[model samples]
Target: MEIQSTKKLVFLLLFLPIIYTTAQPLIHHHLTILNDKAALLAFKDAITEDSQAVLADWQNSSNVCNFTGVVCNYQQNRVEQLRLNGGGIHGPLSPFLSNLTGLRLLDLSENNLVGPIPPELSSLWRLNELNLFGNLLHGPIPDSLSLLSGLFFIDLKGNHLTGIIPSSILYNCTSLGYIDLSENALHGEIPPEIGNRLLSLMFLQLYSNNLSGKLPPSLSNCTILKWLDVENNSLSGELPTQTVSRWKLLELLLLSNNLFTSHDHNTNLAPFFSALSNCTHLQGIELAGMGLGGQLPTTIDQLGMNLSSIYLQDNQIFGSIPPTIVNLSNLMVLNLSSNLLNGTIPDKIGRLQNLQSLILANNLLIGPIPPSIGQIDRLSQLDLSKNRLSGEVPGNLGNLTLLSDLFLQENKLSGISPSIGRCESLNKLDVSFNRLTAIPKEIFGLTLMENFLNLSHNLINGPLPLELSNMKSVHEIDLSSNSFHGSIFPQLEGCAAARMINLSHNSLEGKLPSMLELPENLESLDISFNSLSGEIPVSLGGSLSLVQLNLSYNDFNGPIPTSGRFTNFTSLSFLGNPHICGSIPGVPVCK
Candidate 1:
């Protein structure tokens, strides 16, 4: 009986040691799960694998919890926050993140993660903020993300994600304050039910997508919604006038590059702006390129005075220049081009002292230009071409030294004001289709000119001005369809750098100027419809860059120059000269 009792005691003692051995590892697993090792690995996985040195010292070190971009809860050693933002890491996100149960904040934004978000992240129910923006992740957002009930901010913008945004995720996130999915491939109509549910949402950005359909009227439920941007999409139909009527706190409304058509026109906008005016903090409004057809609202100047920029280009809007527009002094850019606006530009336009860009071209505006336009010293671009504006060109325009392009073409302007020479920075000047008889030689003083200069289809009847060569910096000059008479200026040799010259439809009577050597950079030369009587310069054909030459309708009596540059020109370019013959197409061959 004593030997049997001793054997049972020995068995009991052995069982005790075995239980202790297994329990030790289990306790260690729980402790290590919340330790610096897990936090380091999680951070490493969030960033590029190439960032080995980021937490390298923490590797295998026992003091990793105190390292940079790591946070721990009080009393316990568990990690509650992991912030590794702005770290240049590239590669897919790690799915092992589900192991960190105590994590409340994870900011891996502005990194290089390049795969679909792991659905396993639903295990992070304690997470309050999840920012994975400015990455290369693609694919539909995870449906399990709805489980994060505590989430207040979810920013996944500036990525390549596709598919429709899941309504379950949005509708259930009642605590969400900010949701930005802009610059993505998310498509499909925004669900009205979701908008109705997420009343706490403040910012909703879904711009730069292929999403189509009308905006959800249920958005009005979000009383705190401040910003809503849906620009550069395929959305159509009338704007959500009903939504604006309800949400008076809305600040920014950008609906550019959409097919939003307005049936009510002036009245439809009245409700939108009237409701918008209630939100006194409203600072921005953009509705450009929407195919909206209506008159420029006369009362718009009084509305939205805080607005800094207004884009109304690429529409069918028509009407006269509203005198009230002079009141919008805070406006920086007012683009009203490509419209059907008529009547003279109101003199009151000078009142927009802060205006920078005033684009009103492609309209039917008539009468003389107002000298008040010179008062806009800050003006950068002024396009008023393709109009019926007549009278002398204003000399006061010289005050606009910052002017880059002056397009007064196809107008009835009668005189060329010498003040144009004062626009030292002018790059492009087109005053074609006018009734001017002569141009002031002072215009040649703009030696810094580099773009194009056109003065065609006028009644000017004088010799090609000798000062024309003083424009040595000129790239191209078009004086076609005029009545200028004289030999091609010998001083043209100074313009050896000219690229294009058009002197067609004139009564110039002289041999081609021999003193003017063949241009080295000349690309196009059109002397057709003139009485030039000289052999085609053989050197003119050898210029490798010369692409087009029209010497037809001249009185040249000689065989056409066939060497080098002439070989590329067709006979049609020299056909009208009866005494000329060449071995080119459309010309009689020399017998």
Candidate 2:
């Protein structure tokens, strides 16, 4: 028996080494898989809140590649991508993800992820796309990200990221094409080296940041750039003529809300227009709110025929609307409001048949609105308010069936053509502070009026139109300071979405409607200074949404309800109504 045991032990010892040697490859393969698998596990651990149950199935028994939002290569051995956008996950990102050396794309956008982006992410030397936008991520972008030499697209937008964009990224990641760091709290000058190395950059969006400095002329090196949006920054400098001339392929240029002056000491825009002359691919250009002082130069035609929208609102630009402006046959939007311009609108303004919106409000322009404006069949928003122009509103305006917002307020518009009601799509109509005598009942019948219907401070004298009830979706109505007289119509019940209704300072005379008949969303109702006579509707005090109510100077009588929302108001709300008393502060209770 001893001889047999010895022989068996020797046989076992000899085969054990062969068994381990044969299984070595499988063990190594498993260790390699754990590289990414362990990192993902750590990621799951860092997520303090995963309301979306995003990692519910991330179990050790399961393959890491099969995890939610994870993608793997053809070999199914290594994770290549991780997309978890809009997952509602909360917590700091796991720095352990740096273990995923083979990861090429990482997208965690639209999540609640907070804290600094892991600087260790720079270890992903082969990463091609990185999207961390729409998150709560804060802290300076890691300058070490320049290690991703193969990366092309990186978007850290819509986050609280601060600090200057890393110039190292621009200098090292030469393969980058798209970089969007907009909507962040990032401050500092856009690196002049932006275009020095990133010649392939096409879309450079750094808008809505606290960036301050002059636009770098070096940007011209990115000649293939298409979209350059750096608006809402503190960039101060003359509008770029020499730099802009190089972007022949540029499509949209938004430099709005910056401190830019035109050429010739900020008074001449001709050079800037000429610079854009060759950008035939230009579709839109916005210089709004830049305090740019210049006149409408005839060289504006040089902006190319494909130019669709030109926004220059809230500037000091002054001059007549040049006839040369009509040369852009494809112009869709032309906004020059809040400028120092003085002159009659170009008579041939309608020649731009494709014009959709024409805003010339708050300017010194005079003369009647040309009837030819009706030729713009696609006109949607027309703002000619706050001007000294005087004339009857052209009836032909009704021809613009697509018109939605019309602002002719604070103007000398004496008469409104009833044909305006034909603007079947009109959503907002404001003729307030105007010299009008009447409102076309047809205008009140617009059921599509969803936003506003303001005719206040006008001389219009007549019975309130019964069609006022047709504004089923109108959120606000202001007919105050007008001569509208007649009984308060129960038709107001049709204003289902009305949040505010002001008929104060009018000659309205009648009983007030029951509070139950008011719009469900009505938050404010002011009938002050009117001749409305009757017992105050007791139900008004029970309104759950009425936060403001002013029946002052009305002819209401009886005890005002002291319950519900009424207790939230003061005596001033019911003052001047000799017979009405309430328990409100400073008001005498009914005796």
Best candidate (score: TM-score): 2
lDDT of all the models against the reference?
0.79, 0.89
Instruction: In angstroms, give how far residue 70 of model 1 lies from its true place.
Output: 9.8
> What residue pairs are clashing in model 1?
48-89, 541-565, 541-566, 542-565
List candidate 1 segments past 4 Å from native: 1-161, 173-185, 197-203, 222-227, 245-251, 263-269, 470-476, 490-500, 505-509, 515-522, 552-588
What candidate 2 gets wrong by more than 4 Å, as runs, is: 1-30, 49-52, 510-517, 532-544, 554-568, 578-591
The residue-by-residue lDDT of candidate 1 on 492-547, one tens digit each, is 65666689999999998878864456467888989899989977767566668889
Candidate 2 local lDDT, residue 435: 89
Clashes of 1: 4
Q: Cα lDDT for residue 50, model 2?
A: 42
lDDT of 2 at 414: 90
